[model samples]
Structures are given as C-alpha cells and as structure tokens.
Target: MESDKIETESLLENLCVGLPTIALKADIPTPKWNTLNPYFGAEDITEIVDWPEFNYNTIIHRYGGILNSKKIDCVDFSAPWMHTEVWHKSQLDTRLDELVRPHIIRTLRAAFEELEPQTQQLNLNPVTFGHGTTAITIGLFWPDTSFTTVAEGYAQGKNRAPGVLGISPKWSSEWRHSKFSNDQHHFQYNQTLAELNFYMDGHGARCGYVLTDAELVVVKRLDTNGRLAVSAPIPWKTGGNGQLSVRLGLWYLGMLAAEEENWAL
Candidate 1:
C-alpha cells in the first residue's frame, strides 16, 4: 500500500504536469484566459503544492477560458452574494446554486473533456451539488451522492456545538495557534471540522471545499487518520493574482473530484 501510494503520488504529479498544455490546447472559443500562481495561505497543511503545470510560463499565455478570471463573467455582482463576504447566512444556498457551484462544474466538465478515457482510466459522471439546508455546500460527485448524509453530518456538527465562521471551530483566532501535528488541538478537534469530514465521508469524496463567500478553503482527505489537508481562507472575490487563484485552485479541485480515489492524497 505504501509503495502504491508513492507511485500514485508520482503519477499524479506527472499526469497533472501536462494539464496546462491540455487546457491550452482546448480551444473552447477565443482569447479568453490567462495564468496565475496559486496562493498557499495555510501554514499547517503539509506537502504544500504549487500547481506550476497550470502556470502560463510553461504553456500558452492563457488557459482558454476554463480558468479565465476576466473573460468568463458568470458572477452577478449586483446580487447580494456578489459581495466579498456573504453576510446573510440564509442566502448562502443561493450563492452556491446560482454562482459558485455552476462555475466549478463547468470547469470540471472542461477538464474531463481534455483527457482520454485511457489517460484518466476512470468513468466520469455528471458533477452536481445539493444539500438539505444552506449551512454548507455539498458536492455530489460521480455515481450520485446522497443529500441525507450531508444533512445528517451537518446536523451532528450543529448539535455538538453551534459555531459561526471566524468565531469558533478554529477559524482565524484559533489558527493563530493551530499546529500541523496530529494532537488533541489539531484542526480536526472542533464541531465544524467534524461536519466537513463526515460530509465528505458520506459522499465518499476525497476532494471538497469550504467556501464562506469571504474566503475559500480547499479540503483534501489525506488518509484514515481524520486529518485533512486544508488551505487557509483565500479571499475569492479578489486574490493575489486577482480572482484567478481561487478559480484555478477550484478547477484543480474539480479535477481531483473527477479523479475520485484515483487522485493522490
């Protein structure tokens, strides 16, 4: 299993190394994309990855609208969810349904189309999103994941201890002292972490995300240890390379979702 993991990681990186060229070759339409470096804000997440394959330095100048921050303008800035921070908890579902989920789904669809079945060696399915309530967004990957599990997992979290983003469950305040070590005080200690973990577990998903409208966090289940490789809150409305960082990151995550268990941890 250890040797397989090593080979899988190597293959994963090698396979992903050509994604930029693949994305570049996909002439979906016109000159509508560009490149940017990924921002790594989470210090606790080990094996930090810089997706240089998707960088324009290697491939063509743009990523062919699949990762275009300026070209594909699906976000409605006038909507309430359009702001940097989604202040209204009730409308969180609207943002996911109307904006975030659709964009990422398209990204995955575009990504999957670029790969051959022999290259991917996995059956891809229609990616979608749904949940019982709007407290969190749940991804429905290939083979159709259940929404009840999402609701139940989220309910378990709420039942254990109510938490508001940034206030509880190891947000910015706790992150100041958060450590990478697997101890009692690891990132998985709180109720919110439990919710995120169980939510992915229910879907049998290895790749997931936590998008609070203010900032985005990428969560990857590493192993059976219950510890996740989660990114720090990256401002999605605008990032270091403008909005491209979050989109590219999310696109990479979408690729991981399609790969499912085949993806490297």
Candidate 2:
C-alpha cells in the first residue's frame, strides 16, 4: 500500500511538472467544428471566436461587477477574521464601519467568543498601518538548527501534506541559527500569511492590514471535480513569533476560506 502511494505520488509529480505547458496549449481555440461524419479532412480555419457576439469583456464585467456589488460586499471589516494588532486596526476600523454596523459587530463577536474563548477583544492598535506588496512572516514556532542543507530540510518539511504555492516548500537554512540535523531541522508550525494588499483604490480599498492571528493551521482536503478544500487545524506550536504577512496581488487564501465554508455546508 505504501509503495503504491509512492508510485502514485511520483506520477502526480511528473504530471504537475508538465501541466503548465499542457494547459497553455489546450486553452488555444481552434476553428474545427464537428460533423455527423465519422471522419473528415481539414478545412480553412474560420474565426475561432466572435468577440462581439460573446463579448468576454462583458463577462469579466459581469463577474467582477457581481464581486464588486455592495450587496455581495457585505463582509464585516471589524470581524475577528480581520483581526490585526491595535495600531493596524485603525486602517480597517473607519472604512469597515462604512459597510457594517455596530450591531453586526456585536453579533459576530458574540458568536466567535462562544466558539473560541482565546479570541481577544478588539484593542484597535495603531501599529498595523502600512501598505505594500511584499512578504510578511505570519508566525514562526519550532526553529530547527540541525539540517546541513536547506534543500534537505525543505524536502522533509514539504513531506507533511498539501503545499502552499507551486514551489513545493524549499528550506531556508540561511535563516537558520545553525546547521540542521534531525527532521527538527524542519520545524512544524502555523502561520496566517497573506499575499494580497487592499482590494482596489481608496474608495473600495482601505489603507490597513487584514486582521489575522498567529498559528493558523490550514489542512487541505479533496473535493469534487479535482477541486480542493482547506480547513483550520489545531495549533501545535507553543511560543514563538506570531505575525501576519501580506503581499499585494490575487490570493488563494480566499479560495481556502470558500472551500472551508462549502465543506461545512
């Protein structure tokens, strides 16, 4: 059974390596239309897509518009999910209040407090005010200083489960205090990292950090039609640097949240 799992993983690894080019080639449209005949010869390639008729621009507008609508934009900015430090909390405070009312905040907080007692009340710190597209270290727990090479530690670290990004988890021995030895050379911890900064301009977007926490464990599960879902894992690390890192761009964290909700339903 274990060997079969290894063989299956090896096949998937190879497939993943080739998927980018395959997807690029497959997405190109051709003018080939099928007929009732079992076989047919080549014909002049016609216009593949009627841009005016279908109007993909309108489609983008439709999708983006719906996502942009005030009705759908009913996310509570003050919610614990948006929890940043007190200083940084201001960036979201005034703007989020524009969308959500005090009553909503109270309701959400009440619910969260019941589910997780560790949730701290809003302190509205000012330290979290900043903006940019760069890497932010969410949190770091078990620091391993044993591995000789970062590549080795990275490979072992990635063996845990579903990886973040396509990089397949590389080690950062350069960040280590010393050489790595045991698998401890590869620490196991949780982080609430973000690569997206703000939504749009100042009107739609605000200058603030998305409130988050330390030691957020994310677990991936398979769904229908090759989709995936991620769920929160139980925090394992004890004391360490709990931070929130965000970059400016499209993010997959939203997808993880959606999957978690879908799985819950």
Pick the TM-score winner. Answer: 1
Model 1, global lDDT:
0.37
Whole-model Cα lDDT of every candidate shown, in order: 0.37, 0.20
State each candidate's clash count.
Answer: 0, 19
Question: Per-residue lDDT of 201-265 in model 2, one digit per residue for the tens?
Answer: 11111111112112122322222111222222212122111211111001112211112123121
TM-score result, candidate 2: 0.16
Query: Which candidate wins on lDDT?
Result: 1
Segments in model 2 whose C-alpha atoms lie over 4 Å from true places: 1-181, 187-250, 259-265
Point out where model 1 deviates above 4 Å: 1-88, 113-126, 129-170, 173-189, 239-244, 260-265
Instruction: Please provide, for model 1 over 1-265, each residue's C-alpha lDDT reduced to its tens digit, 9 standing for 90 to 100.
Output: 4453222121112112211100111232322211111321123243422223433232224333333322222333234434333324334545455544455444444444454353335643323233433223334421111122122443232111011222122233233245655343444323344454555554455556554434446566676446566555545444332333444555555444444344324
RMSD of each: 16.6, 26.4
Q: How far is candidate 1 from the true structure (C-alpha RMSD, Å)?
A: 16.6
What's the residue-level lDDT of 76 in candidate 1?
32
